[model samples]
Target: MSDEDSRPVHIRRRGLDPADELLAAGPLTRVATGSGADAGSQWMATTHAVVRQVMGDHRRFSTRRRWDRRDEVGGEGVFRPRELVGNLMDYDPPEHTRLRQKLTPGFTLRKMRRLQPRIEQIVAERLDAMARAGSPADLVEFVADEVPGAVLCELVGVPRDDRAMFMQLCHGHLDASRSQRRRAAAGEAFSRYLLAMIARERKDPGEGLIGAVVAEYGDEATDEELRGFCVQVMLAGDDNISGMIGLGVLALLRHPEQIAAFRGDERTAQRAVDELIRYLTVTYAPTPRIAMEDVTIGDQVIRKGESVLCSLPAANRDPALVPDPDRLDVTREPVPHVAFGHGVHHCLGAALARLELCTVYTALWQRFPTLRLAEPAQENRFRLTTPAYGLTSLPVAW
Candidate 1:
């Protein structure tokens, strides 16, 4: 291994702060991503503007493939597990547009607003569980971890009995420490479950997202597409919200006033949710974008086929993006942060995430006005290895 790869580099974060290297990466810098399919040198977009530019222009920087080749749409020629389908992030326009258009109706602001009562109920139930678990409860286990999965099950129309199984599969698939074979096995199992659910939904549609898609689009939305949708939703809905809820609570715990700000009023709560998403960009980086052609971003010329990883945390924390970027301020006027990402492949569940967060943050504090950490913040384990950054176990007291 080369010296750069040999050197320890934390690309994600040190607690809530972006890794020193990422923040100091200036506009664009070449960085080695140790090992993976994405191993080797790539351009890192640190500033908000550059990241936005890279993400916004899909033609110049392709999300689908590094080279211009006409293979089958969803990983046909590519050597990946067959179960990985319908994820919009893995495709470019036309294919991406078609799938996104089909899924967009289900995640509209109106749909999310309609789902608010249920979201509130989920939060209340989670908080009650935490309360029953009593003081010094592990918030991650009792509240943060459970709520998102439960809510996702509800959204996706997985049976109550199957929710636990579904969550288990999700955890198994997403746990980064797991071997690739193990993770892929979990993914295959998850895929099998989704495929079965899709088949059932097709036969007898229910009120959930899968059923709604089945009923509306019918054959136009293939089983592969539906499976992909569910997978993406599960991936997006579970970890991102779970992490935000866990870490947002931790952040708010430190800033007592921010917790109050979340409980203040609708407008303040909305602003607080947006601000928190910006501050704790738990989805550390978006899927790395491959340059379709030689593109000059800042002073650097990214050659064709080169990959660019935009640091969401660093970009969000840039002084150019917001004043006093490091400090968590819920009261600040909302800025366009790439927390959910920018442009075409931006998070499909952004509305649902925001709704869940707004509901949870407001209700959690209201339910337990005296909520505080059971142990020192330093003792809490941060989930650094996972795709989403969060607390592994947050012991809390009311």
Candidate 2:
């Protein structure tokens, strides 16, 4: 069948279901197959086609302003919550290049290597806390949720006492069900907190990234800009890493043989992490991009100013790209996946995220050889309604 003729068939086959099942089923479905505002939206059903088109031709598809637009919608305006997080991730060309140049140095292999020992210490501390809390503890509530935020706080120079509050603020903004009033309050409070932290860093300066950014930029970086970068990095780093840890653990539990292979051989952890990222495609969908110019994606004509959402989950699972994509195989060879995204707006913290995932999976499985889900695998809650997909709670026992 022609591509156009197959679109409807694809849509009909993938019908709307919970977000978890949508993911568990595999990627590259017809967008109209799902419920939500995008349901039946022509642009939605063509997600897989559009992603292939975009990845194949980067010039026509841009990520600039995608996340910014989401922030505007989520924050309600540029003046409040949106202002608290920086625009580094949402800019194009020269500006993005400039910011990335300044920031990329810190995420280098040398820097990540230095952070490794500390990450292990932090992981052990968290696992110890979980052990103290006893069995059947929520994996998300303890290790997956807390470790990344704490690590981010240390990296950005947030006071140790304030890490919990910072995490809470991050969640409040990301949670769609949060009332406008609550978001506003959280935004304002976070802005004030960040501004204060930036001001203090300017005066005393520390060994962390915030101090380094301040030292390099000095007076050139305004309070708003510094605070924005901190908030953006913190949120981006914490949320994705946390979700991956929780989801990776769940994946291992579901596939016992894979888990055994991974734990029995240290070499398998890296490949397993890659496969989990590919299979889970945890971020779910890419931010909607507005066509800056008239663009032809595949056979479809996309008009200027129209919105296009790329479902990473679908793209990662495209049968054309990954053979037998539904089957989880830790032994799968290195294959390029868009879990961190594609194009200029790809995730800046990709290396750090991978490090954390490797650490979590390696440590968790090794520490608790008999680890298994405390609840029925099917009963576990997955975050299907959000822009990012993950579990709310991952109860486990050893």
Candidate 3:
């Protein structure tokens, strides 16, 4: 029931249970977004209903308007050459259609289920390593970053040994603290690194997603397009997956009873994963949208060319979405939440992410029944600078 009513949407205390100031000022109000003098205000879709309205109605609120189309080819905006922009977040309709069609098969239910066994093995391996390393292990380093990071690497055909480089690149690019030039360089470097793997996959479809895409499409898609697509999907699950794993463990340990419910059964743990995603809302703010034309959402009219932001945590935590909204109950029945977003722009890696979470929570806790925070929960650093919200390092002792 308590939401920040007066304070700005972007600023919040940086730790576990950070104070949410956006709700205090009231939901669905305009607030200045950045710290700079040139910072302009935009309407924040804070409630579950409104956020879905904007994301769902892609026609009215186009994500492409934020960038100029003049730099790219055709009407596809920056997505024309396709190497310039990340997947569907850039293009609309036919352009989005073209790219989404090619990538869809790689994320199919069959693919996820197939990946499940490998994911469990990865989880078990990391857990075994942690056990060998003894208690008081840095879960973020040993288990969290390692588990999903490796899965994503394998999925994209990146070598598991090279994870450190990509992890730095992924985290640095999403970081808001870094200069724009610095972030752009990191992103470009990430794409370039994937180019090598894509080239390799071209000659031999190596069972990874990049190889899978080449297998189906053949020469229909250019290397550049495939490279950009690979880069986007590779990083898609990078921070969010690892963040959820680390944060999920932290949340479960805090509520030990909930931990017991998720420790073994995959079916129950799968449902609990959705609840955890809703409760955490770790990706605090994703890309903002701009109105292609004047759009009326709820009682407010968002004018043409205006940017719209969605506060994921606020919307997911909205009382209207569920009773006792702020309480983190793993037993809550699944409701429509915008944690992975809604409609056309909904997360492509969502199914894969859920499978990863289910495996992590179940296999991880089963391995360490005595898992507890190495330091006080308040002492752990909250990684607020990046696009996603997660712990910088989670120190846990079993």
Candidate 4:
């Protein structure tokens, strides 16, 4: 398919043309998908200023609307349940504050540093397994997707034997190509698992993030609340890391100088990871906030209960954000971007994710310096209509 024809589904769903003056047109514009869910027209913030503004003002804008996934998508949906919404992203103010206070310790820089050696070990082991599998390998299956899945299993205290089932549930939840019924079923099953595990944790609070939350919060938090947070963390990590790894590799290969730098040392790899995250803007989070009342955004008044969507990619790519926004230069100095979002809802797993990406990008190329894409970038199927965007599979060779 032509690049024009194969534009990201989110852009299409929002009814915006890529060639249009996205920034010059204005910060806030209205777009409607064909679906009846948004027949009235939904507001989209397409520039850095407006997106960051909408995200920063939580009092005027609310995330309660994010609960209904299918409705928000104008039909397309994921497995995460609005009913089980206890994550920091799903709440505002005091409720979000309480939850974040308890969960932040588990995601602190100290913990991420401690987890670095293990991540390196996992990346190396996965690369070794990929080597054994020989040429023309599927990077998504062998490395990109599997690495995060395995890491998530450990981070959430899932047993080694259950990683396969866990990944299946995650894939079913976020893989946009899957039928809505299947995705919903996966979400339901994960909730069930979390509930049972929450019950067990209430009794013992074993180890790892979930367990630590259970131990730390105790009677302060309910089973439902705890389960919701865990589910959010797992789903968020599963999709985001996989996408970054897959897309980051493709970006690096397209810029061999960057690839060489990424493979050089830890500092270079960290720089490469940040640049990739900024360029890819994979999460596209901080979208879809509902106005609490008369929310004035950039001279436009969004009346009560109006839907607001922030275009993270457009925001990240804004020329005002940085010079030459389209170029991918790993050596460039890191600039603030909305990839992890902004404000109180910034990604909790940012530290750990950086560790993972830094470790994998550097080590993978170290293990296979001759690695190259086995298929054209366009030939690879992308997971569209999902909350987070990424490849379905990346065929590669060394």
Q: Residues 304-344, candidate 3: write the lDDT tens digits.
A: 77888888887887889989887888887899999898888
Where in model 3 is the C-alpha error above 4 Å? 1-8, 11-18, 25-27, 35-37, 68-83, 160-186
Better of 1 and 2 by lDDT: 1
Badly placed stretches (over 4 Å) of model 4 are 1-9, 12-25, 66-82
lDDT of each: 0.83, 0.69, 0.76, 0.76
Residue 194 local lDDT, model 4: 71
Query: TM-scores for all candidates?
Result: 0.92, 0.82, 0.89, 0.88
Cα lDDT tens digits, model 1, 150-241, are 88888888998888888899989988889999999998899999999999999999878888777888888899888987888888778888
The lDDT, on a scale of 0 to 1, for candidate 4 is: 0.76
Q: Which candidate number would show the highest TM-score if scored against the true structure?
A: 1
lDDT of 4 at 95: 70
How well is each residue in 38-70 modelled by candidate 4, as lDDT tens digits? 446778787888888888887777675444545
lDDT tens digits, residue span 1-398, model 2: 63323432322112112133333433223245445765654354223444756644445554555344544422333332456335564554565677766666556787778788888889999999998998878999989888898778777777778778887887786667888889778867877888888888889877677677777777766787677777778767777787778877887788788886556565677778888888777665555565667876556677765556666766667666678876788889857777787767777788788788888888887778888899987787765444455678899998
Whole-model lDDT, model 1: 0.83
User: Candidate 4: worst 10 consecutive residues by lDDT?
Assistant: 10-19
Q: Which has the greatest lDDT?
A: 1
- Separately for all candidates shown, the number of backbone clashes (residues 3 or more apart, or on different chains) is 0, 4, 11, 0
**Model 4 clash pairs?**
none
Q: Model 2 segments beyond 4 Å from truth?
A: 1-42, 45-59, 66-85, 264-267
